[model samples]
Target: MYNRKDKQLAQKILTFSCELEEGQNVMLQLVGLNGIGLLRALVEEARAMNANPFIRIEDTEIRRILSETGDKNFWKNQAEADQLPLMKKMDAFVGIRASLNIYEQADVSREANKAYADYFVDPVHFKERVNNTSWVVLRYPSEAFAMNARMPTQRFRDFYYKACLLDYEELAGAMKPLQDRLEQTEHIRLKGEGTDIDFSVEDQTWIPCFGKRNIPDGELFSSPIRSSVNGYISYAPSVYQGKPFDFVKLDVRDGVVVDFDSSNNEALEEILDTDAGARQFGEFSFGLNPVIEEPMHDILFDEKIYGSNHLTLGNDYEIAPNGNESNIHWDLVCIGADVYLDGEKVREGRTFITDDLKGLNPENLMQ
Candidate 1:
């Protein structure tokens, strides 16, 4: 009952995540809506590969509970439980997201959510997850996500599915030129109409992650020094956790966000004020997927837009090979932005230098 596209998607997941090792234990957490089919297929694929797989499904009601109850202790306990066992047992973890609204629980007190968020992913958990497990964060489509992307539901769903089918190898190949440039550069600067930022990378800090834990695209990323950034960035008309932020501008000095400004939202203020570490830079990455044509307003999709890139402040997931700090992570994406490494233009306006890296082609993978 599987279509060829579905099979291709499964293969892409397996290849990119490096999940075929015999006797490896696999754990997957599926959020409601986006990744149901892919999760089902992935579970089966894991079994066929001789891996023991466990799956968990999380629903929106959980958000409702944390929001309505205002119980930080409950989430704290839950966080402990969720992470400790994974740290002890699982060899691989895969997260499949299909969220459209991050602020669905905005009604919850910011203080409570901040406490919960702070505790949810403990430092120990991050270290364990990053070091031992071969992990991946992948996307599935949903109506809410389609709306965020400004695309018709069916069309966007098709686009995501097609993107999922891209060949992992080809995508990595297309990114080699850019990776080469970034690896050789010591400092990279980002400037825009309302933003000017500069940061230095440790020698060999920028790394190219490919062939595992990523697919359909490859990116160059690094963990910047905790307090080394200087400048301002404005992200308006962007939504996070289902909440919209208008004209959000942040001023940075020595890598800590010194001043934060937002129009039409006080929630943004609360987020940055949560902790001293909240404003720290966590990860910097450039998107190499050429098929992603525009910003969908969803970090999962937008962060992968070809030639586009994003810098996440706070809480380095340690997903990249590089090391960064903090436990509060927020991704700010820039669309159609020009990306450079050592004065070489690797991407401009959503296109890579490689011609084959255009569009979501299964054969090319780079797109």
Candidate 2:
């Protein structure tokens, strides 16, 4: 049986996030069995909206098998012949992922992962689904998710619902001033322990994201100028493609990553070497979710931690493009970074000190 929160979240996804209209089709993608309750709720919610809902279930284990066995041509065929057509036809998409074990795909070879990402994920989902359709993607609370968050199972569930069900309209209003400020700024600087970076967002558009593209979201993002990023940044620990990374540091010169180091060096090298764009910065953003405060080994959650900011490597979003494109879009987070705009210190660690932006601080936002 589905819980009330599941139904509530389902309603939000359909009505608020995707805005599923009558007679339109929305694809619901479930990545593991643990999200079955939420999936059922979404289906019911879609039907109530008079929208035709399509289901596509995927398992991480099955995906690992395919990656290990399939060749380049195999992934290409799957993307072209199967996934792209369906994604192109959909009016909206809602993806809910869960995992029994976070390391299910940890052992897949770099070559195989590259093929899967290049042929299948990039073309079908990133290009077609993201740029074309109204969509929202989030992870369902599961045992593995709770463990990653360092919380008990039931407590994590409660926290997830609370975080995801915030008053997004109010949050968006609070973010408006910051967005305006970003639009007017030319150079932005970041400083923290083991991190010092600065870049130009001159004419780039700043997008205020509040519970639209991503659930539990409170961020404002804009891509740096394609050739304007310089200086190094040390990111907090994170997980990518089911593998853990810590103390990840990158040295940048003119937007390209000149050198890098990480706890998992081999995997980090694979990501940076994916393509030409992979070495350059793509998206730069501030995290403003008041409820979340720490890394959870999940990008979806960690990228929204209130005291943090994240920079993406490779593949800028269509909404905020810096002309950097690649098979990977990695969001590396840096916590407690002081932010400066045009030489003015606007944020000191987790607190926004600017008068106009003070409402975004955790204390004020939670009020």
Candidate 3:
């Protein structure tokens, strides 16, 4: 018997998150069928609502081999099959990743990786997925994820679900104050140990993400004016594209990354070189999920850790078009950073200093 909780989660994604309507076509992309129970549940829910659901399963090991053998041309044209017609046809897309190994691609050479990513991965997969249909991406629990969180098997499972299946409706209701704050504010400043930065969001768009585009989402984002950023910022340890990096320090002046340093210098250079916009700011968001408390280097969780804030350096989101364009959109997180709105403290060290966000305080939420 499939677990009832898994089915419930699927129903939440289909009915609540994706909001699939009758006759809509939804696509499910699974990794190796590791979470087939949830997949089956999703199918049942889709049919019940008179929505059509289809699936595509991928094997990472096979892709790793392809990466080792394929050249630039191979990847450039790889997404032709799906990108041409199928992606446009889908009304919604749900991706479930249950990869057993997060470091499976760590050994892939940087030259090949960069070439393929620049030429193929960006235009084929990411661009369409973001611009065409409603999509939500999430990761299923694996031993690797548990280990990364430094928790035991059952303990991590509990933590994972607790974070994902949060009361997002309540979250949405409480986010109004912050959303309004960002919408009205023009100049925002950030400061913390090893970080101090200034940026202006004058006339920029503020987007509230509440478990729609990304699972475990509880943040509102805005774009920094392309020429209004000045100063340095630091970030916590994070893994990107199968590599571990930490202590990311960026030197930004007039909204450009002049010089940057990190624990992994080579990877840093590769990411910054992804495109022209890769060196500039894309998105700035405040983490509001009281349930997510720690940084385990997983962006989906860390970016939402209570009182945290993440700044992206790459392509601007479609919702908040910053007039910046790039194929890369990398989220770099700053833990315990104090955020200032018009020179007033609003967030400090994993807690909101403002009274409007009292509902988000840990004491209030856990109660």
Candidate 4:
């Protein structure tokens, strides 16, 4: 039997998250786990609103088998399939991730995984899905994810729902001042233990994503000028594809990561060397979700930790384009960073200093 909560969450994804419209066609993709009640709710919600909903589920077991055996060229040919055409036809895309095993691909070597991703998954998802559709990606609470978070299974489920189903309208209204400030700022600076960085976002558009592109989303993001990033930043541990990157440090010189390190030093270097744009700073953003307090080994959640800021490497989204394009867009988070904008100590330690942003003052919103 499916829980009523599943149906509730699915309704939010269709109605609020993706804004299912009349006559629109949506593609729902479930990974590694199933939520049949949520599936029913999504289909019914779509049809009730005159939208078409269809699902294409992919299990991790099958993907693991493909990655474990498929050669580089085999993956390349798979990429050549016409999935792009079909994906482009999608007006809305919703991806549900509830993996039973976080380390489901532990047997697949890193090199094999990278090659397969470069050819197949990355091309279709990044090049096609991200830029084209009204999309939202979210993780369903699962035992494995709860274990990674060091929380009890049921407690984590409660946390997940509370974080995802925020009153975004109130949050967006509160962020208007900050968003306006970002639009007019030329240079921004950040400082903290093992971190001090400078960058400019003079003309770049600033986007405040409150439960839109990402469920549990509370961020105001803008890409710095590709050649304007300077100084260094030490990020808290973050995970990518089930691998933990801890104490990740990067030295930026003229917008490029000239020096970098992480728990897996060699792997970090290889990731940055994916392409030229991979070495350049592609994204800079703040985390504003007050309830999400710490890292959970999940970017979708960690990147919204209230007191953190994430600096990403690789392609910047068109919403705040910096012209740095690559197959990678890794969001590395820095905790307890003292953020300074245009010489003013505006926001430090996730707590705000500027009165202009008093609208977002946690005291006002959290209750």
Choose the strongest candidate by TM-score.
2
TM-score of each: 0.85, 0.98, 0.95, 0.94
- Order the candidate numbers by TM-score, best to worst: 2, 3, 4, 1
Q: Which pairs of residues have clashing backbones in candidate 4? A: none
Ranking of all predicted structures according to lDDT, beginning with the best and ending with the worst: 2, 3, 4, 1
Which numbered prediction scores highest in lDDT against the true structure?
A: 2
lDDT of each: 0.65, 0.90, 0.83, 0.82
lDDT of 1 by residue, 1-367 (tens): 4445656676666645655577887777786655677777887788888888888787765755765675667666766677666555888877776555556665777666666665665533465666777777776667877777778998977887766555556666656665666666777666566766777765645666553664444565777766667887765356664567655778888887888877644777677766666677778887656567676666655666665567776777544433444555777776555545556554454555544333322234532
Candidate 2, position 108, lDDT: 79
Structure candidate 1, residue pairs in collision: 101-242, 102-241, 102-242, 103-241, 103-242, 171-366, 227-254, 314-328
- Candidate 1 at 254: error in angstroms? 2.6
Candidate 1 global TM-score: 0.85
Worst 10 residues of 3 by lDDT: 76-85
- With a 3 Å backbone cut-off (N, CA, C), the pairs that clash in candidate 3 are none
- What are the runs in model 3 whose C-alpha is more than 4 Å off? none
Global fold similarity of model 4 (TM-score): 0.94
The local lDDT score (0 to 100) that residue 154 gets in candidate 2 is: 96
Could you tell me the TM-score of candidate 2? 0.98
**Model 4: per-residue lDDT, tens digit, 1-367?**
4677777777888888898899998998877655455666777778888898878777889978888888778877776765666787899998877677766765676677678778876777877888888899988787888997889999998998888887888888888898998888999988999999999989898999998789888999989998989999998877665566767999999998888778888678767877899898778898888678889888899999887888898888877888988877889898878878788888777788788886665677688
Residue 22, candidate 1: C-alpha displacement in angstroms = 2.2
Cα displacement (Å) at residue 364, model 2: 1.3
What local lDDT score does residue 193 receive in model 1, on the 0 to 100 scale?
Answer: 62
Per-residue lDDT tens digits for candidate 3, residues 88-133, read 7889999888777777777787677766776666775667767888
